[model samples]
Target: MTQTSATPLPPPEERRRLREAASLTQAQVAAQVGASRETVRAWENGRTTPRGHRKEAYAQLLSSLAAQTAAQEAVGEAEVTWRQQSTRPLTPAQAFDALYAFCAPALVRQTYLLTGRRELARESVERAFQFAWQRWPEVARDRDPAGWVRATAYDFALSPWHRFRPRYRHPEPPPADASDRALLDVLLKLPPPQRRALLLYDGVGLDLPETAAESEASTPATARRLLHARAAVADRLPALSDPTELHRRLAELASAERLRAAKPPTVRDSSERRARFWTRAAIAFTVTLIGTTALTLRTAPTRYEPPVPPGQTVLGVPPKVAPGPLSEREVELRRKLREETASGPVRLVPETR
Candidate 1:
């Protein structure tokens, strides 16, 4: 960087980017540049200025790092893994396998960090990959398939609805380390938006703009959420106030856990199976709808039928009088009729005639 006319070093953020892109830790840069790690950090953060030989050495290291980063970009570190399947014509399965192999393990770990549940993490990554495979055509055409899958996994892992599921209703066990448990507790306490912003920026190494785009917010709003998340974490764990330190801690926390993703072939097969199941379900639903529609069309009345009229109240009619107590003459006649014999008086006279 200082070779021709002593050009000035790049900006602080650029310096940090170069170092990280080269995968060199601050201590490694410090060792190479003959300075303390703190000094290297300060230089990268723009907190302090380097001088003389150290400054020139830092510049040289940065130059090397930039070259290294550029070389990797040209050659493509991850592209090498899929060079055969992605570059050459290959079966969709092979391409999917390649992608699954490349992104699954890290995705699982990242999900684990997001949810603090190992089983849930694995499930989320698998579900994300399944969704990708189910829509492989779209995913293949995507600019960054890994990014697409990562967003899916994050959405699943951090979903509020998971709390309603029987499996995810209760809290998962805390990390074995007290500090880790504390940090995780603090992290989960943040609103999902803030948590997601923090993870995408600090944990995932995305630039602020990319993070904002992933978070689907304006740049300023994303910055505010990120700052708020960092402030919350810093309040709980004062040591993690530094973004770099938070990144390191997040990486450490994820790496310390034994997260294992399903094999690529298994994921592919499962995705295929899931796709088939849903397709069959959709077909069944469509057939049922068609049958029901046909039955209704055949059985339904051709014209509108007026409803039967309800019963009406009857009009006034004769009010029959109930019988009352008998008069004395009527009573005497009923007594004589009862006293007389059955066929005596009138029947005998008709027989003689």
Candidate 2:
């Protein structure tokens, strides 16, 4: 008979011991060691064994667990030794090292300020330490891991998708009074470039160069923007004062700026064009309307009366009378003259004959 040998099976007791040593939950260990939770469970139960890279990963995981346990045990021993050696309390530095290993007030403040989310900032710091612990050799050899950690925090804080990216979302105004409303009303009238320049410089108290940098504008451009912004605000200055009103004003300014940017430019043939196209168009329209109205009024017809009804007249007036019929005496005298004139050449005897 040929001799037969069996492959070694995973020991349930050893797997359980490794799990306990690693200070990790099954899920955590499974994730890190690239094994399924079921596979880890099987191994712990001595039902199956990992092979190839999986076996190596399993061994490394168990080793890491053992190291973590040892470190904790050592820390516990040291604490106990310290307690026995001194009845007095530990100094702040000693206490911090004992509790957190490392801590700094400036770092805390910066973490909070940058993240704007206290919890997230704290979590980030915690993860930084955890990462350092996992990769101590690398982090220890690096000359500026602290700088790297800070940069990570800042990157998280300044991400475009982060809520705190703008750092001025719905900025709280000083007060909610008439002055604020007035200030907003004035700011509303300004164009966007002017508004940005004015607010960044005057409202935010940035110097000219700083404002230009922030706005991504040239100094001369910024100055012009400020001038226009000032002119607009000044028109309503008597009423504006409150800071919250600034947002409303800025909204209006932004809208107007968008519209202006969207509007098409009027074409000019010459580079040195002095005339404003819109202004000229407006003047032309007004003149044309006036001329049309005048022409219409001049050409309108006049009303006619029937020539004052013949002889009838007004004011120092006159009137006409009908003509009389032929007189009866003239008819009888003509018959008598005819009888006497019957004689040839009747000597111009009067009709008395």
TM-score against truth, every candidate: 0.62, 0.22
Model 1 spans with C-alpha error above 4 angstroms:
1-86, 302-353
Candidate 2 Cα deviation (angstroms), residue 208: 40
Per-residue lDDT of candidate 1, residues 29-107 (tens digit) = 9999899999999998999988888888888778888888888887786677668655678798988988988999888
- Model 1 lDDT at residue 221: 98
Model 2 regions more than 4 Å off: 1-11, 88-353
Task: Give the per-residue lDDT digits (tens) of candidate 2, residues 59-82.
Answer: 766766667877888999999999
**lDDT per model vs. reference:** 0.88, 0.55
How big is the positional error of residue 79 in model 2, measured in Å on the Cα after superposition? 1.0
- Clash pairs (backbone) in predicted model 1: none
